[model samples]
Target: MMEYFYPEHLKKMFTNRKRELKDLEYTRDSLDKGTLRNISFFGLRRIGKSLLIKEFMYRNPGNIYINIEEIASSPEFFSLRYIGYIAYWLNENGDALPDDYMEINALIKKCTEMNIKALTDAVTKLNLEFSKEKRDHNFLLGLAFTLPEKICREKNKKIMLFLDEFQALAVLKKSPQVLNPFALFRSAIQNQSGTSYVLAGSQITKMRSILEDHKEPLFLQFNVLNIEPFTREDTYELCSKILPGQDTDIFESIYKYSYGHPFHTTSVCERVKEYSEKCELEITNELISQAFLVEVLSKEGNINKFCRYLYDISLEKARGYGILKAILTVLAEKEGTTITEIARGIKRSPQATKKYLMWLEEVDLITKYEKTYFYKDPVFRTWLAYYEKGIELGIMPKREMLKNLLSNLEEKYLRTSSELGRAKEFETKVKLEKKLGIELKNYMSKDGQIEIDLAGKKDALIYLVEIKWKNKSSDYKDIENFLKKTEKSEFSDKEKKLFFISKSGFTSSALKLAKSNNVTVLDRNLEAIEAVN
Candidate 1:
């Protein structure tokens, strides 16, 4: 069994997050120059929000980090427990850090070694007049936020406080009427001269309400940073770190499985490594696929917990859980379905289904693009597909269950792969027209037996386009048949031109035939065809 990732282990395993690091550096520079405006970061869970913050602190000394997820569990409700973390940093870094701008609270000073309740007791012992109105959230937040600002103020230094899982403050609400400690944070730091904050969270709805919602306290007040997945080059680098000398196909398989999600990428790769160790199996496509299934379906504690977290958040605390589950199934099984289509699938009203989609979207389970909705996590969609398909076969026909199951997964992969093709085709159409200077329209034969991916007329010449996405290079026979059929059927008397686009480059024969027949070939970006002209 592999050892669990500890802090030291993590520091080694960390992949390059260039964009996120650059963003943090920009924030620091802006703070020094006195132009920094926003200080909040949001991303999907396990997409590495916490990891980024930790890496920042590791790289830069004199920074204080606290996980709000910890304070959320304290019995004292809300208090200045984080002051202790800063005090520890102060003691550890000493003059290497900025001098204390103000007299450190005796109680807050002990924050380095004591519990939050003990720290609160020190506040009482000192008889501080922090809050005469109430010792509730505002009062506690006032004391906590002040120390960091003062540290910044007198020394002319910027104390970077990283609050991980910051949306916990939104969850820590005691009552509807209680003043939000989060807003207290905004008010405290908005005008403060010396402090910089980096608030990070994974709860999309709560975090958005705290920072993006119009009526919320911190509405649009935070500069939000989004951490995207690793690029292809970075993903390859990460894979190499795990297991070098692997085939390029292995890395591509991981990339397709992870779809650029950081955590999923790491998890699947690690599990694949384990499988290879135990079974001495070569890293084949089948090996990668099974590793993915084992990790996603595993009942091991942390994996189970993570899956539960996904299920709970995606359900958004059971607001129409069953119906929403049905909705999710539809979204998983059919990519790019609108609310109406999902509603029809689940036998619900479009309006009701739309409301559920809003919740799912707010929770970051799915994202809406124009008129269609898609699972934000493709691996999660794959899991759902497996479950739904398993139930449909009713144990399968006797002994062929394994074979049938493999067939089902293959079909799911095809559907998922087809989604990429659809997106590529649409993008290619726009690029070809923009780059080559022509207007393209979706062309379907009236009989519906034949169709062109894109077709349009440019003055005296009519053009037809076919965009094919396949693992293998496209061949001449495919293009030849399309041209012959269109010539004989619709444009026999019209002067015509044909363009063939492929994700994989055309075969030698395909290129030769296309050149001799006045056909142009381009890549997905419509780049190569300019040379053909």
Candidate 2:
């Protein structure tokens, strides 16, 4: 029973989520005015959807929270079960019920018995107004709608109800008795006033089926909110708190591996701290490598959990499990590839491969850019690459997955690191432009050979930026090439101000030479390595 993210005491120590919190607050306010349009949002599993909604419920008093997945498929959810759940939650203040209690309890019992004619007769006996003609409709709907309405009226307060993993309830639609239960609920609850209802689900495709189907009950009824990863600043701030005294490079490595995924970041940080302390070593590149093997390369690791989630969901969506696996294997074996290339890898046609690729994109497991598709999380892609390698070599047992990791390490690292470096430079251009208060111009030579990460000017000087996100620092040799390019008469008038950005900083000699030549070395700290003017 080891807890993730530090310890039991620190479980509720939420990190940077001000934006989502503000948004939920706005949602509650709008609900008070009945102006909020969206009631349902979708996100990937473990992307903190439940945690986010639960926290919002805690903040907004009188909010009722239910994880529908727990009782979704069972008869308990359809019976008077939800009424009891609401009653229990209300009694948290230890209060007695109103005077009409006997009649209410009787009605609840009649509703639970769930004979269509009997329930219809009970509704009439009670003189309850029908929301939708009151036929043999959803048994759970009337009660769920009534509870919130009653709570708001009796308690003299508005209420918010958060239903997490609501897609699980779609299972009930397949039943004969309550066909299209979602529409029934929509009809009942949409009429109720003074209560805000939020619905959320994890499975992207299943959720779309429930909420997006044109013929379905809840189609486009709920608003959508997608919770994304923390920004680099938020990620860095969190790492500073979790791993005090760790250098900037260490923090960058944590972000790089986790890809700003909250669960992944916390899990990796916790495990890194655990193993580093156990081995009596400081956190370093080498130590992180060891931690990745021991903590995540194991069968029950977070990496395995995410990979399995991807596999299961893909199986559900794709035409055939073999084709889906082949597509994932192709992507995992080599990323940034086209459908044609992937099809060729799996010996399938491009048209056939495109279906699986589109399905993966629909599930948010992968993203398509121009003609190439890649896993959203680069680390996940890395893990899959090695995973396929292990399976290809017939490596048995989960613990033995890392047997050939060393053999595959150098080349894979080189390829992935180079890709990340190129991506980060593009990001750096934005960061530098914002920090310097100017936009950088981009250009390519007529021969399409020359490229620039960033080329802008400040006042009367030219700023040429280079970003490297690798273990080794940029050396004097790198600056030497820039010096040669600048020697052209193209830059004779404007002074050259070189801004060399490196995650690992520059060599001492590079710093010395660049200092003499007016070069600005931006070390891992993102601060200038000031060469004394």
* All candidates: TM-score: 0.68, 0.65
Task: Give, for candidate 1, the lowest lDDT window spanning 10 residues.
Answer: 94-103
Which ten residues in a row are the worst by lDDT in model 2?
Answer: 93-102
**Tens-digit per-residue lDDT, 1-533, candidate 1:** 01121266777778877657767877777778887555788888888888887777777767777678866632133443555456656555322322331234544445445343433453563235343444444555566666677666555677677888888876556654445666777777777756678889887667877788777778876778777777654565677678677865677677776776777778878877876887687888777766665565455423334765788755757668899888888887788988788999999899998888888888888899989998877777766666555533221123354455556666764344334454455556667898769998656554445667678888989888888877788887887887776776576688988888989888787888888887888886676653232
In terms of TM-score, the best-performing candidate is 1
Tens digit per residue, CA lDDT, model 2, 366-424: 88898998877666666666676663222123334444564465455324333445445
Q: lDDT of each structure?
A: 0.68, 0.63
Model 1: pairs clashing at backbone N, Cα or C within 3 Å: 38-223
